[model samples]
Target: MKVGILDSTLREGEQTPGVVFTMEQRVEIAKALSDLGVSMIEAGHPAVSPDIYEGIKRIVKLKREGEITSEILGHSRAVKRDVEIASELEVDRIAIFYGVSDIHLKAKTKTTREEALNVIADVVGYAKAHGVKVRFTAEDATRTDLNYLVRVAKTARDAGADRISIADTVGILYPTKTRELFSYLVREIPGVEFDIHAHNDLGMAVANALAAVEGGATIIHATVNGLGERVGIVALQSVAAALKYHFNVEVVRLDKLVSVSSLVEKYSGIPTPPNFPITGDYAFVHKAGVHVAGILSDPRTYEFMPPETFGRSRDYVIDKYTGKHALKDRFERLGVKLDDREMEQVLAKIKSSQGTRYFRDVDLLEIAEEVTGKVLKPRPPERIEAVVSVKCGSNVYTTSVTRRLSVIPGVKEVMEISGDYDIVVRVEARDSTELNNVIESIRSVKGVESTLTSLVLKKM
Candidate 1:
């Protein structure tokens, strides 16, 4: 399956209060993320700091040194300096963001629509001339007049935007509306690639992402753990999962998802809640007795997928909702079964009885035997590990998981995986003593935070 993941943690993730990454930290995170298998990395906005130039430079160096196959990109405004800085850094791609909606054009840029179009022509053309692949972002494009959005995107394409991103900057679009708008843009415009950058203000980021894709969007802009301005942008985990699990698209390495999210969390200091999609701690965990039972019998029964498909493991959370049917169902494959009458009897007992029922396979059989004349024989389950692949254009991802992973540096790589936690990495530390130096250096990457490193048996 193929889906691209953009790390805005440096740009947007840093926007979270009290979140700051030294140049070293930024480099560390970026390197780790590159190893994690995201197709693209939005390194950061060079316009934000004097050190940004140095940061981008270091990122390019790290990517090259680590043999990272991912693309390195920089963000800019639709202006000369923004494009100039990215060109200076030699980044492969540059995204120039501007407000095209009438409201932003008037309030933020204070330029008329014609003036804005002129700016687009001038700046975007310049960036292309400088030999940088361009992606022009019409900020808040969803709210802009359709005709105007077309005008701006066409102008950018004419100026040589390899692609144009239609942004729902305020997260106000519904899935159907998003599909309608993007489909119109797709049918109306044929050559240039369409991209979507949706926000999560209304908790519809994933829904909108899928809608845009259906409308012919080939690229998606997302942040780790959905970190960004206001409610955040599309989440790397959510989009990756949708593309992989729901649409059978391939642009991500599902096995590396957790490893990627953890790094973002540590660097950005914005934790993905337990329930966040895909990478969230509870995303694949079964807590209810019924769910747990289903998983125990056949993971696909309740999960439709195994956690390992996404670099995660399944977990069973004990709670007050346990039921004997659930208990029996879970261990049924282990030659455990309860007759229908016994099943109803157990339910009645539990409904009236107090205390928690912690069921194990043995306990289930014992209960079954007490009610039945014969003892049930134990049998090994007929377990199978199978994969179903689909062909979509040039990508193939299972429609079940958003697998993700990472390379390592203690304290840095572990934190930026986004959405949730997963430990998967191989760090290159020269020695135990220099691990601190490794830590400091690793922290410079964009999404790195914690390391999953152990002391070496012997330093080479």
Candidate 2:
């Protein structure tokens, strides 16, 4: 079965508390999503703020110019004014939402069901009248009575809604219930495509989304990192991966998933957790000895899906759990042939070390050299350059700090600078580990309050 994806990273994703994207960031994200191949991009609510309206306008302009290929969507309430505002922006589709559940209708909308149905008809018809496609969302549809929800959906369809979105707003639906609900909707409301917006409050957004697909939902609403209000919604990457791997449906450019995810992560300022699925740092990293051994023999033994499928690579870490096989493999990869005794001694030394639990490549190399009593060829150096801004205490003399910083091993140039920071230092290091050491040494200077580092990716 085929399913479409409607990415709301700029709409629902911005609703994440304390999250806001600059106009440039919004455009960049939209372009990335377009390249990643989502069916539609819900830019933002045009009526909410002038900035949001302007962002949507710029994104719509990009779509018009063929810079982005995905259809742009606008969000609105089931009010004429909302639809009117959305209409002015020229979005390909406008998604209008209203509470359908009794709890929401009575407490939030303060209207009877009959009156609410009238509002739906009026706004949907208004949007359709403007020659714009319409999508009607029954907010809290999961908690609403099934018959009433169907009535609301049918009312929208009759009023010319192009699609109906069944939102599990509070994440109350499990897999079985989600399947049953969408199954009924597909049966009751024919001729209109259905979309599923599953929240992650109960931590089943991806599972429920897959269930909705099984129940015949043709579209799934998602965000770049599952970012949305409260606990957010289903993740775009997880949904795409599940669809492709489990259901044999391909809907997106699978190789671009991690790049887009990283783009959103950078703009949102919310770091993706190391253990997050699909695009996380440790998702493809193996640490345990048995797991690493199995992975070395055949990745399929430990990994159900290969990292290369999503433009990622498998990684292994050496720790106290390191086994002889893993150690030998590491040594061989490094072009160092280790005899059995030398390998055992190195492993024993690594396990007994009390400094840190995980050993870096440099640390392992040093240990191997010490244990083998042989001068191993030095690995090729990696050049990394960075600019660090240092903040100094008010009472401290800046010159003394700069002088001390200038004497640090990797410090190439140190200059006292005005503005937010007292000193700007440029340094080059062999690798990230060495770069971190340089930064730590800079922080240890007496007058330094704090330091911010920006790596130089390319030089003009």
Candidate 3:
């Protein structure tokens, strides 16, 4: 199936409570989204603020300069001035929205349904007259009377809208209903393509988006980390992954999802929940003994998709539930050589350590040495230990900085502290080459300004 991704991290994502993206951050995010191969980027609502308008201008300039390939979209309302402002930004496409549901009309727009249709026609036509592609969004479309909603969409289409967005503004649709709605719209409207703008108020945005596609939507609107108003819209990563894995339709660059999600998580100041579907930190992690054993035996037993498919690695945790298979795997991977007796001793100590969820590589090394009464030197890839202290820009979020650092493969620990350096990260690697690569990755993070590293000479 052919599908397009319209990521709104800069628009609806900004509407997330207390979330704000600086102009530079917005540009950086746009670049990342372009690299992820999204079909369109809803840059921002130009009518919302001057800063947003300027940001959209810069993004459009990037496209003109050939720095980005995604089509840029500017959001607007039914007002002509709103469309005028967006058109002035020179965005490749303009998205004009107006409430079509009677509830929304009475509560928000205070306009009759007929008047609403007239406004949409006027504004959508105005944008098209200026030679810009237009998408007319019927806000709260799911709750709108089906016949009236169809009329609204047809009005916009007649006025030159190239597409129509069926927005589940309050996220009240079930997957079946969503599919039915899109099917009806696609059957009713012949020329214009359909886009699904699903909100996550009911926690079904991703499901609904996929259903919409199954019905006939060619475009799925999403935001990184599900950032938006209320519970947010469908997550860009989740929807993209679903499209590729569930339907075998690759809409965006799958491998770039993790890095792009991290970038948005950092800038949006909204942490991706550990349980988030595709790009969460624990998405591919296994900790339970039974699960770890199954994963070790055959990843297909516990994993539907390999972590490496998304440029991520599978991880395991060592805690009370740690089984022998998990322990042995960790030990061997860390290059820790121990006899059966010593391994049992190590497991006992770990299990009895109150409730420590994780042990740093250095801590494991110390424990191995203590149990064996000899210096346990790990082999090649696990031989090096380095402490890296990172200083971030004054304006950066320290928690986000720490979260970013903690996810690096070699990084074992990350702490935010009050000092010259905002964060300290401990990393384990094989040699200087791996160490340098890890450090470079750290330096490349958005807020990291500088880093100082020191190699470990001895654990004691």
Clashes per candidate (backbone, < 3 Å):
61, 0, 0
Per-residue lDDT value at 392 in model 3:
96
Return the clash pairs for model 3, or none.
none
Q: Clash number for model 3?
A: 0
For model 3, the stretches where C-alpha displacement exceeds 4 angstroms are 369-374, 379-460
Q: Write the per-residue lDDT of candidate 3 for residues 1-460, one digit (tens) a residue.
A: 8799999999999999968888899999999999899999999998888889889999999999999999999999888899899988889999999889999999998999888888888888888998999999999999999999999999999999989999999999999999999999999989999999999998999999999999999999999888999899998888888888898888888889988887887676566767788788789999888999999999989988888888888888887788889889888887777889998998888888985768756667777788998887653334688999999999987887787677666788898888789999999887899899889878977689999999998876
Point out the higher-scoring one by TM-score: 1 or 2. Answer: 2
Q: Each candidate: what lDDT?
A: 0.71, 0.90, 0.89
Alpha-carbon RMSD to native, per candidate: 12.2, 7.2, 3.6
* Higher-ranked by lDDT: 1 or 2: 2
Give the residue spans of candidate 1 off by over 4 A: 1-3, 325-460
Question: Candidate 1: TM-score?
Answer: 0.72
Candidate 2 TM-score, C-alpha based: 0.86
Ranking by TM-score: 2, 3, 1
lDDT of 1: 0.71
* Residue 259 miss distance in model 1 (angstroms): 1.7
lDDT of 2 at 302: 89
